[model samples]
Target chain A: MLIRRPAGVVFAAGLLVIAGGTAGLLLTRHSTPALRPPPAGVAALPVPTGPIVAPPQEQLDKPAPPVAKPVSLIIPLIGVQTKLVTLGLNADGTLQVPSTTAVAGWYTGSPRPGAIGPAIIVGHIDSVTGPGVFFRLSELRPGDHVYVRRADGTTVEFRVTAVQTYLKDKFPTEAVYGATPDAELRLITCGGVFDAATGHYLSNVVVYGTEVD
Target chain B: MRIVKFQLTRWRVTVLLAFLALLVGIPAVSSSAAAATTTGYVALGNLSQTPSPVDVYLYSSGNSSPQLVEPDVAYGTILPYTAVSPGSYSVKMRTAGSSASSTPVWSVNLTVKAGGSYIVVPLRTSAQAGSLQVIDNNLTTPSGKAFVRVIQADLNQQKVTFHCSCAKGTAGDIVTGAAPGTVSPQAAIPAGPWTMTATGPGGVGSLYVPLTAGQVHTEIVISGPDNSILIENVLDAAGAGVAPVGGVSTGFGGTASHGSGVPLPWLALIGAGILVTLASGLRLRRRRLTAKG
Candidate 1:
């Protein structure tokens, strides 16, 4: 049987999941004896508070560098290697979906890949024709690798941290789109049961990743 | 016994003294570390009629030295909040990509106060002259208290009143008939979810405003062809200020715009189930034949 909770309850549950994820990060850091302390200068910066989560070490070492446009994305685990296209807000202010089913769209309003904010990329689960590029996006597991090649000839690697499914009505818009202090990635696709009557998926599957290099 | 008791008392005194020293010295050390550089936060916004991008500079001195703070700020876009020190600053605005030696289109001098947070908007004056619109920000919310401030920046609207439909009851006329460039006083209300209603010369509209204890927020109602509410999560010591929360539409329209439909992938599931069942049936038949043979 399918159960539907209030939107507030769903949002709170998402937050709990995210909180558990960061707590696990802290635990892993503490358990690893080989982890080195931050450099003298980095140790001096004010401890990040609030929504601006401190980036992992690789990102902490670099200040706000020149933003590089992402040219391509490669997720080997899901056999996804597709070029990225820029997307903007629609007339109604919602994100514009990619026109082609086989292509993924990155939101232009957010920072580009390898930048100091959450760079959002979204794809359709399936079009009227067939399955889309991110059809198997939900198959991705934690620790799966995602590579984004930038126009500057550098590729930023991200490690998957969490994958969550939320009903479209209860989607945590702020958590998905809000600004972050460090470089992050959110890959989204429509998932859950498909309704023939509505012709739209009921939920969105969001894959959260942190830039490793 | 007497000697042991005396030694124990001495040890307890030493530990208490150490704890007292830490209690008093921690804040002193931290304050002294940051007291040398007094600072405040400031954000920039562009709300001019022109569509061209603007380059904003802050001159601590006269027009001699200019520090380009925000560059290529497109119309209707707001730059991030930054820290600044208390001083007399001359805000200069010019066409983006223009040479530093070129003349600025407009300039305004502001005496910034220490620890003050402000939103500086480059706007056209009543006479159509370029000017700066400074909105002072309040980041003080006592425990279990939240605040709401209204800004009427609708040029065409003659006046607007901000009403609140809060949990306990409705508070009407929180901001009564505020004009352009007018900022309503920050009103303290119980921290919770509020449906803020802004009725103006154009029409009436409402948006959800979630408030938490010890958090302050400012809502600016802008009117024109594209009317919207801009919510600023004012910076506090707790964390970095949230990026400008936009897309709060407030005009003559209902806010029920979300798409509706429950999806059921029963056909796919049924197909998969049938395939699995047929495969298992074939395997069972083959096993029975082998056993019988």
Candidate 2:
């Protein structure tokens, strides 16, 4: 004698069987196909004769030029000789500090000439522990000599004309770096009496120089 | 057939559930997307009188990359842009199609929020005269008197003439024919767009002042040991005074009179008296000698 099953149980059993079948079919269809060797005597397909787009003539004619490397600085008067890192303007419009405290050089803005218009070079008077490069920056007197070696193997010489000390707040920015018809050089470093309270130097020692030639 | 019906019913339920899930997720995605966008307008201030093309750049916080907006626009023109997820931003304004020599004219840090407006005020260039005082002693006499006249050589050329006369008396003494010593036009003198030249005993100097509509050219002459002449709005249409170029002289016409080509009555009278006394003495001496003979 066959026992009558509940309608829900019958429906559940039917749904499970259908789901299993569907899943199995989908899995089989999606399985990776086996690789087969090519038939003997099969010829390779011919490449289509389509229009070949030539790359831009200008780009092909002239290869991309390499970038120029920065120059190094050596000043015998102040006893500074080191590689200079480019510095930019800070958020507050003040100059940015060089990554390396040993030597810092300014990026020539449009108004300023490359190695002209009083291109400024700055370095630290002292590092965290002791005296660093440019420690004797204030001692630079008039008529001192400064040398800068360019990447192209040319060295530019300059003569110091004046050395001045100015309070940081009263820096003569325009007078020092403003428009100039001739090439000039300026070296700056922290100076004046050191203040224990503030780590920053109170004054800036500026050495003004003109090209030797 | 029963199994097919059960399967069809289960599939429909699953599809319905998926549709409901999509409906629920759509609102959340839309809200977040809306929150990420910011809309605002930028107001440029203090533009030049003439329209100049400027490039506007927007930068994200501490990001070196800048998005260029409004490649070019006339001066005083406002540009608006949309940004995503507003925070601190820097605006760099530069002269479009110009070299770095035309470095960015304006740079400022702004904190922008979702749906907020920002205003940037640029500093305008202004023309100013250095100083407004002159010094010329030859122009100022010991009597403290001087003479000044203004001559309009051209529609725009106004020449100032300063003269000091020692014959006028002490440094403070006023000359009879001289006016108050200041020369200014009742109305704006339309001088050609050239500099005004001022002449005095000391020398001649040029002044640059912008001339504008409904303006007047005026000359101000000062009389004293420290003599100065001031020209206001000489070139500036906005009414800025030209620096006073002057001269300072020592006191003129002192007690010891040097020959100034002026005939002194006292000197004449003293000479005449001396001549008369000598003549009378000679005549008396002759009469006494005849009586004795």
Model 1 chain B lowest lDDT segment of ten: B248-257
DockQ of 1: 0.04
Tens digits of per-residue lDDT, candidate 1, B1-293, equal 34434653564454346434533432110111111113555666666645358888878756577755677876555454456668777777788988866787766777667556666776643335546777676654443455667766555566778877776554645788776666677786676677778787678767776565444455666544455443223222111122212221111111111222111132233333333433433343344446555
TM-score for all models, in order of appearance: 0.40, 0.30
- Among all candidates shown, the one with the greatest lDDT: 1
Give the deviation of candidate 1 from the true structure as CA RMSD: 24.0
| Model 1, C-alpha of B210: deviation from truth (Å) | 0.9
lDDT accuracy of residue B215 in candidate 1: 44
